[model samples]
Target chain A: MSMIKTDKLIYEYAKLDDEGNVIGTNRAIDAVDLEVEPGQFVAILGHNGSGKSTLAKQLNAILTPTEGTVWVAGRNTKEPENIWDVRQSAGMVFQNPDNQIIGTVVEEDVGFGPENLGVPTDEIWTRVEESLKKVGMIEYRHHSPNKLSGGQKQRVAIAGVIAMRPQCIVLDEPTAMLDPNGRKEVLRTVEELRKKEKVTVILITHYMEEVVGADRVIVMDKGSIVMEGSPKRIFSRVEELKKYRLDVPQATLLAYELQKKGVKLPDGILSTEELVEALCQLN
Target chain B: MSIKLENINYVYSEGTAYRKQALKDVSIEIPHGQFVGIIGHTGSGKSTLIQHLNGLIKATDGVYYFNGENVYADGYNMKSLRNQVGLVFQYPEHQLFEIDVLSDVCFGPKNQGLSKEECEKRAREALEAVGFPGKFYSQSPFDLSGGQKRRVAIAGVLAMRPKVLVLDEPTAGLDPAGRDEILDQIAKLHKESGMTVILVSHSMEDIAKYVDRIIVMNQGSKLFDGTPKEVFSHYKELENVGLAAPQVTYIMHALKERGFRVDTSVTTIDEAVEEIAKVL
Candidate 1:
């Protein structure tokens, strides 16, 4: 059931000298292994320079693994011949919407991917329309991408990938540039995508709130898979996650603090209501 | 530092084949010393609308009024308006191109035709205001961490000494600490400077927890304008418009759906905890 898999994933950026010579290689992702099952929402957490994004890129073959292997939909990303196939099966969304969006209009931008994929004219429009509707952007289909909000443009960017109908989607800090409302929209759309399209989602983010609803949570530190579990399990270790420079959800953190201060309670509290119900049961 | 948008409409590439009507008949008033949060689903015209208040974009129809007079009036001093209404753009780090942190932060004040001595003082103060240490002034912004580079960008805007400060998605892309650091600094700046503050954000949690008032937009129209509670109460409407308030509210809503008598009025964790204490 694993749709995307990684083995000993390693990536290095050239540490150049003053004269532009490669003095050494700074290891971005180091000896990382990951697997994502079909129809699962996976979140990766790491601090800056921790190589989370590097791994997201590797899944789509945007950057080949320096010393590892990645398979998307059972197609090896490192295989030169399978580059296009791997990419078509695993779409990528990045940090900034302004940079990724290309079309002048929303629908046209969504259609660009299918059109480039050599889909027939009639079918390209069909895919574009459905993708736009999926993201709840059909109303602004004729609007300029430039005129769209950061969140809307990003949805269009997602629509562009959905138009390709990829089996798996890798989003690198997709909500990093959105406002609160926009982030909600994008998250809802991603959740809907999993249910409606059943695409495997690999979401790399640092926001603890965003990960609460995810199916599985993977924590990366110094370019390695440091922690892997469901959100409840990952969030249960409050001090441990905080040591890695990650924040647990506020309610979870509060529950942990209260536990430390002599309250007999459970380990992980995912939402406010849970914490409220637990504390309310005081004997 | 009040900003009044009077029937503002922004059209990109006016009279061209690729023209876009970004903002349409949008009229809203933000008063002095008010903490307002602007929220919208993508393409809802919040970005376009905020840009007009600072004269970043000329309104195609209607006008933007700062204080009392129209900003886009004939021969209006746009530069002065800019100096008074500092706008920190989203992805602000992309705009930092100076060689050193000091020079970059000084860019805004220097453009205001201030003396080098005055500009330097403001830059130093602004950097401090944004919580950047003294050591960062000499270092290149590129050498700093992503969070620090973002701080430098905000400092650059702060150096303008604007009475009305506008931030576009200031906490986007930052981790929880980075987000809290930036949002707290903004709150402090508003208190210390007594400036009118407009925060544009996507996190309903952040908006609900911080700003006094909330403005929601959808497809270039203002869906509703009121307190966060008032706006969040329209959960169905917001969901229909591709928006939601906070996760806590959603959870409470879900609890209500399941026959739990938990108060759905709470928009945050602390409030939710207090309410659930009463219910359970």
Candidate 2:
């Protein structure tokens, strides 16, 4: 069975008037049927207000579907009792580290999630240690979260989520506010966590470079899934992506531009290494 | 009017055991009507330096001059200095709180004690400058989309009519199209008004495309300051400071290493395409 399954998910919310009267509804997620097997790393790319984040919120029961259903680890999120089960099975990390981190210290923050789940005190400490190690943040376990850099803080946030022992993790642009080095550090940490823990990852981001290595790429636009394929297949269609107001990696764009100039080049050049190898094949 | 700093230093928690020096012996000059990009790793004093430009933070040491007047001098009019230098912090959308877009944009000028009619007129013009629709002027800022909200926040600053505009990572979380639109608007504003523009960003590609000059900060000090070509040429130095040149520059360098005679200085995609086409 798939780790995450959504059947024709449609999310709509009422737009309230000044006195709290429902004026109209806005459809944020429209008929998106998605599936992810265990241990899969899926990247979701979309422009702002495209409902990618709304879909992520559904996975962890942050927002139940206005229509249709969402299942996490075989449990339906719409059912009230299964809310805790679904959330524990699928943890979430949001964009800003400052807003998400609540604990005074790094280890304390990681312990909050598992602690709320009513795990034994001794087991919570063990899980915290293991999660911190998985993210390579064990060295700073005692430091205050505020003192840590943006990258380190984000890693701590990830550890906090994984400490709950979730099977799937949904990150909503966790690295959007980070610098380049911070972004690299967070991405590397997530990759390492996926390998060590074998947790499913759904990363929603605007950065095209980060999506190039994903197991699959899902492009969303206007609350609908517009394209879904492997990174190679999706990035190959430069024109389609541009029409959606999305961009490819620098190497991919450069290769595309070179190809347009009548120089023979392969499509979907995702990285500098691949581009270099392709260029060396000519002349 | 130009902004000049000499040996500026800022210390956090001075006189305490945990005192940290956020900026150290930093000095630079931004002439009037210049488009400059500032880049560095986080905590490299980029934010702290920009905060000083508008007199938001007093330097612990060294001197700062705006239009030949010392900003820290006794009896100096800091309010006027602030009115001349406008700053839009990172994630500027968080700063918006007005009931509507036009009122939000009018907040800055209104606070400056401008007449209500003047504030509204400036707000309308600023909204137009940012390409925000006139219909949205009456809508709540919270109801707008992310890109629209960001534009409204920027319009808040533009309404002040500052001579020098400093944007701190104006496109931090915007999508590719939103990023392009915002940057394009800023560039147009700079060209049309000839106002000083200082943009702080992490994306080297953005720096290469728009700014004429680049400033690199490292370890709380001014590391490099020059034209985009001059600054990016030291790719090694940039990497040492936890930064990279534009990806095209690296690509061109790799091609050159493989005996291809492409111009390694090419920073943008179009420039690299042309340079590689020449060799091919």
Candidate with top lDDT is 2
State the lDDT at B122 in candidate 1: 97
Candidate 2 lDDT over A126-168, as tens digits, reads 9999999988899999998988888989999999999999999
Chain B TM-scores across candidates? 0.95, 0.98
User: How well does each candidate superpose onto the true structure, as a TM-score?
Assistant: 0.82, 0.98
> How would you class the docking of model 1?
acceptable
Compose the digit string of candidate 2's lDDT tens values, residues B77-186: 99999999999999899989989888899899999999999999999999898888998899999999899999999999999999999999999889999999999999
- TM-score of predicted model 1? 0.82
Chain A vs. true chain A, TM-score per model, equals: 0.96, 0.99
DockQ value for model 1: 0.28
CA deviation > 4 Å runs, candidate 1: A1-5, A17-19, A37-40, A68-82, A101-167, A177-198, A207-209, A249-265, A271-283, B4-29, B58-65, B69-76, B218-223, B251-264, B275-280
* Model 1 Cα shift for residue B55 (angstroms): 2.5
